[model samples]
Target chain A: MHLRTPLPPRPRPARTTRRPLKHRARVLLLALCTIGATILVSAPSAQAYAPVEIVHTEQVQVGPYHLTVGFSKWPLRAMQSLDFTFAPDGGLTGKSGILSMTGPGMQGGMHMGGPLSRHPRKRDVWGLDVRSLSTAGQWSFTFTINGPHGQGTGTLDNITILAQPGPPLALSWTLCTLPVIGLIAFLVVAWRRHRPSRHLTVVGI
Target chain B: MDSVHAPTLTGPGQPSPPDHPPRPQPAGAAGAYTVLAGTLMSLVGVSWDVQWHVDVGPDTFFTLSHLMLYCGSAIAGIASLVMVLRATFAGRVGRPADPTVGGSPVRVFGGTFTAPLGYLVAGTGAALFLLYGLMDLWWHSLYGFDAVLNSPPHVALFISISLTMVGSVIVFAAARAQRWGRIGLVVSIPVLITFTPITTNAFNGVSPAIDPQLAGTVLFAVCFILMGGITLRRRGVALSIAAVLGVMQLFLWWFSPWAAKAYAAHVGLPLRDNLRHMPPQLPSGIPMFMLAAALVIEALLRLGRRRGWSGRWLPQLTGAVGGVVLSFSMLVQTSMLRGGAGAGPMGPSTTSATTVLTDAILGLAFGALAGYLAARFAVLLHLNAPATDQEGR
Candidate 1:
């Protein structure tokens, strides 16, 4: 048998006085920094956006301007974000345009409109980055352009919106069966190896 | 000599002193409850996430629903870890080791760590889920957006979550055999909720055209019948549980859409334009049928017990009957509601009589097979066994 050995006592901790003012100042600084960082991070992404796929593109003439308009994705689903670009033949040197959109789900005749800017990388391209479509149905987008010559409006109507895609066939089937397979395998192994040995004594039987 | 004379018995008829005081009723297993809560949270999160996807399209990995899902996983993982640690190191902390607190620990990883089997299983599942979450993020990045539900990463995640649910069931089953058995029934709420998604996958709201309603009905009927047979044992209790589950489903059918709408509004997320005009997806009529099926099974079991009928074929037989009942009920309900409440642009429009009949026949056959399989599996896993003080001893 081994004899027990005693250990030395632990040292007491030193006490310190609280500094309220310093703590308050530090907390205030931290809060401000956090808010500033959040805004800085979120601002750029909010302004410039692009769609996942480019579905449709067409050219139309309005007054002195010849414009090409593109819809980011086809058979659009509700709440999908996509880019709407208008490229003019002349250029967007001293010119600007407004893209006004109206759809089925809009509340009480309200239309969403935003200013289009010249593309940062491309010449003669001006576009409005639309965040999302609120509903699935026919939608109309009217682009009103103002240039040195005059103002002209071009409308793209009857754009069809479809429902979102359903579950992928192969993946869904495999996922549904995977757990069943696991259950079967576990049961099979347990039955072969452990069942007889613990048949009667195991609880809850 | 004086001591011996003084040590006389009170009387021959008097009862002797007890050897030891009766053990205090075992404490409610906190870990079991934690796991249950986590499971429920995960189910809700998944449902909301799906709605969000339908309404708002593809989003980043850091969405609110994803947070809720991961939070559930984290809770289960942490709770399991704590329980394992407490069980393994209780003696080191100058306390008498209590096996009942977290059940018994199994030596694993070449005897490196001693942990309760349920906890170990759950922890492994949690780890797998986290890994799959990362995989899902990578997959989304590579493939753009998976508009489909059954992506590879999602399947992995589902498998992991199922393992966690099974582990939770095993843990509570052990508790149910002891004085703390009542908690098992409580835990069943979350278990049922978690399993509901899996059993109903064949007839998910997204696939209205598929006439696999019969397959879904058979699957759940067999599952619920087995659950009733193994867990409740009493006819009235089983019936009550089935009724409660049905009521709960009805409530969820209404609550889910409302909750999704409320959440979307709160988060400033957009809703599908047509959804505002369209009715919500109809609740699968399985729960009501399950109640009827449970009653039938209870009656049969009682009859069999009185008649000294062989117990071997009972589950298979019950399953077959339950399947038939469920299929017929679903067919009738679908036929009645076909165009009125059942018709959604997203749902299948056709409900022909021929299809219903064929599905019913198939359901009956599958149900019997499922019933037999469930019985064998339950026995192998000791799922229906009574709780005992010592587990592997």
Candidate 2:
């Protein structure tokens, strides 16, 4: 049997019973900062303001198909423009094809008037060459204008556009995001919690 | 010499060893608890979906707040009940340490399970949103109401299903291969599915063809149950209790007449003739009272256990508490869902404040009951499984 031996005396520090106010204050400050940061990051996107109106469309018919177009506040002189496309169902498809004037002098004259007419009433007469009309039957064309002002969509009937059977129904992008974010957050927390810790241990001789 | 030998034969006693280190808690376990609470909290949507009424006259009483309070309290109460019971019993019926019972396996598997469930909820929500998208496209294209509900809702359903499938595969692979990337994939799928629907008008099938209100209810419910299931499953038994209470509450919900009464006293029309008729449902206030009772009983039992007060009465008291909560929740859910006198939108408000309040209360109270049931069942199952697992041990 081994005999028990007394070890050398060790110094002990003076202990206080009071709680640490500094620690609490630090936590409070951190929490407030987090809340403030969240609000700042999630605010909505800004939009441009402009005085614009949706004007009626002009219709063109070819064979069994038709086309309708319209625009407003399009500054042809300023080279700022508007454009759009037609789906088989008369809905807007893809992005709008932009309208433009050929040259600087030609552009400024666009808003001045048409030909020798030079009527200010016909000023800013920008033209959009609709690529092609696809769908048959009583088709409709809708114009979506995006410029210095906000965006607006307008529809005019009896215009024929490109026709296809139909596109495959795609999933909504936003709905797919919720789970992705939540799982990421969960995993990050798990990793942090499971991190290795350093410590000292007494060794027996 | 003999006497000295006798003295030498006496050996020294063994000193007790230091207690084992406190067991490690599962990661993100607390967050899981909070998530579960939030899920049940959403059940308040049920009251707003349908109205409540008693067998009595119409316009007797009505308010959605009372319903919400009842649901929230019920969930909390049920959770508390199981918690108290477990804490109290842990000391008395302490079993030998069985690491396999609920240790690493649960912690590991739980973290993996949540991602898929989240994905499922998100996917389902998305599918519903897609349906609305289709409806919008059709309505704009055809200029008819036929595409309203079926079209737009189809989009959301498609989104929800696709996401769920992807998330589930990721989760499964993560489990088999122990991949961390799977977790990210799992979590992302659900978040996207749920958030996407509300972000876009694709899920807005509120046209003449479809009841936007009803579709909204279905989508929200699907979202809650799926997400809630994921959250609860992570916690294992605690969630199981909530599930039990939720299921039982359904029974009561289908049958009970959720009653509420509103009395208006004004001098303009003599005695009580000036009262405006709201509906047939009377706000009975019973759900709230029952919720309070469940909580109090749970607390007292817990306190009693902590004080080392044990008797035949304790178990009986627990039983009674669980029974009452279970029955009340069931009746209320049944009555509200089935469409009694107070069913339908109560004027301007589609979702009433009373509904939110009652749901929170009921969720708590029912959660407590569910917790109690889970604990008891878990214990029983634990005891029974061994007998079947190893013969003649």
Candidate 3:
């Protein structure tokens, strides 16, 4: 009945300790690190050149200062949204600047002029959003900077504005042809169906 | 009730047994109403679609508004196809064509399929619309979205849709001649609606240039005056049509923004940044002067009748008068409500006098042209004569 005393009660296995708080903290830290890495990687890279599609950039000496001005889009279209940026050779800190954009065919004082600020993402670059080209022709943008070092002015000129592109040719032609063909078929069929009957009636009489 | 009338030969020779001629079957109440519904749906759908583009920016081809437009085309196409099939089968079975079936069947494409001329034309338009819808999707993918109104694909689509409108006009003309007066009135609303998009530049309230706006307004006023005036001979009929159209335009002016907002919310689509916080300005104003212009035209028609004047140049005359009135009224209303200038598309405060004078002159010329064309259209569609006087003519 004892059955060998039930083989002397099997030794209890060691229980693993649960580190809930510590485990969670480690996981949370890992997640934060991953997210930080992702954000850092995705952020725009810093470069000496302007970030937008630059038509051209040049170094210009303006009243004892050196500066670079850039246009964002090439062959600008009427009412095209773009950006313009100015970078002083020294730096943007302790500097304030204004941009005045004027173009041909634009009314007097119709120029887009605004103060430049450090781009939020690119701290070294001083820029402003130019909402529209507004007119088509040659545009001249002038930038004036007043810094603790000195005040200076520079111009980016001969920026050509082109007419906005129309719909693509192949697609336009294809779409236009469909209705014309259908209309012709309809008219021709209608005429053919009616013509013989009218002729027969005239002959029978 | 359906009845077949034997063809009457008016020749003086002895009467002989004639071959079985295709019977004339005017589109009955159901067909008339179907076309009317299709047209209204098209108008609503097109207006909504345009607003969706303005408010929501780019969207896929299968948006709700597009579905609505396609549904309209489908309804018209199905109704037309049904009529064609019915007539074809009826004729094959040697039975009298049902007057409720559709209009008389004309053999199309070497007798491959027999269908009424209106239905055939409408069906062709529907097919073209389908083709263009696909082409538009492709075109957008290639060319990017159009910020302006007159893309080539858009123009093609408009032309196709206009063909459907023309078919509806012809169908309603036939129906009205058979005493479907209410249907004619109902159909005219859609006709006017369809015409509105073609003239969006005139009334869209966005452009600051006065010349385009003036031309657009003149064209719209002249075309509509001619359309209503030439089709309807009864006193007040043209005016009533114009009034109804104006009311619809007003409703759309109010409804487009609401519908756009609601649709964006329902689909969880974020509106473009520019439109998000801005209060919606009404897209355009109804041509309120259309009613006044219509009244003047009616008065002229009455005077013409009293004086026994021929109606040959009546449409042109009506158009000229309507154009002047509409342009003047628009100028006054815009100037008063929005300040003397710069407030609307009419332009800056400096050129009000020049704009008004120039617009007035252009409107007169365009109105006359539109009147002439509308009169010709009416004659072509057999809508020139009164419904009662249309028999045998």
Best by lDDT: 3
lDDT score, candidate 1, position A152 = 87
Task: TM-score winner between 1 and 3, please give it.
Answer: 3
Best by TM-score: 3
Write model 3 residue lDDT over B333-386, tens digit each, in one string: 656545554554434444357777877887788778766665655443331112
Compute the lDDT of residue A182 as modeled in candidate 3: 69
Q: Per-prediction DockQ scores?
A: 0.06, 0.02, 0.04
Between candidates 2 and 3, the lDDT winner: 3
- Each prediction's TM-score against the native? 0.63, 0.23, 0.64
Clashes of each: 11, 136, 0
Q: Candidate 1 on B1-393: residue-level lDDT in tens?
A: 000101111112223322332244333366777876776666656666665654544355556676787777767766776666655454334354333333334544333345655666676566667656665554544443434455566767766776676666556654544534434543453345334444445345455444444575566556645653545444464466566567655655665567666766776555542233333333444344666766776676667656766556766776777667766766655555454354643345455677677766776887687666655544433422223323222
Report the C-alpha lDDT of model 2 over A102-164, residue by residue, as the tens digit.
222233433221111111122233232111222234434334444333344454554332232
- Per-residue CA lDDT of model 2 for B1-393, tens digit only, reads 001111111112212222342233232222223223422332332222223212211110112422352233333323322222232233224332221111111111112111112222322333333333334333333321111212333333333333333333222222211122223323322322232223233445336443232233223222222222222222222223233433434433442333222211111111111123333221221121233333434454455456755432333344345444434443454355444464523333333466545444444444444333323322222221111112111
| lDDT of every predicted structure (CA atoms) | 0.56, 0.30, 0.57
Q: Candidate 3 regions off by >4 Å?
A: A1-205, B1-27, B94-105, B178-181, B197-213, B271-286, B341-351, B383-393
lDDT at B274, model 2: 18
Model 2 CA lDDT for position A103? 23
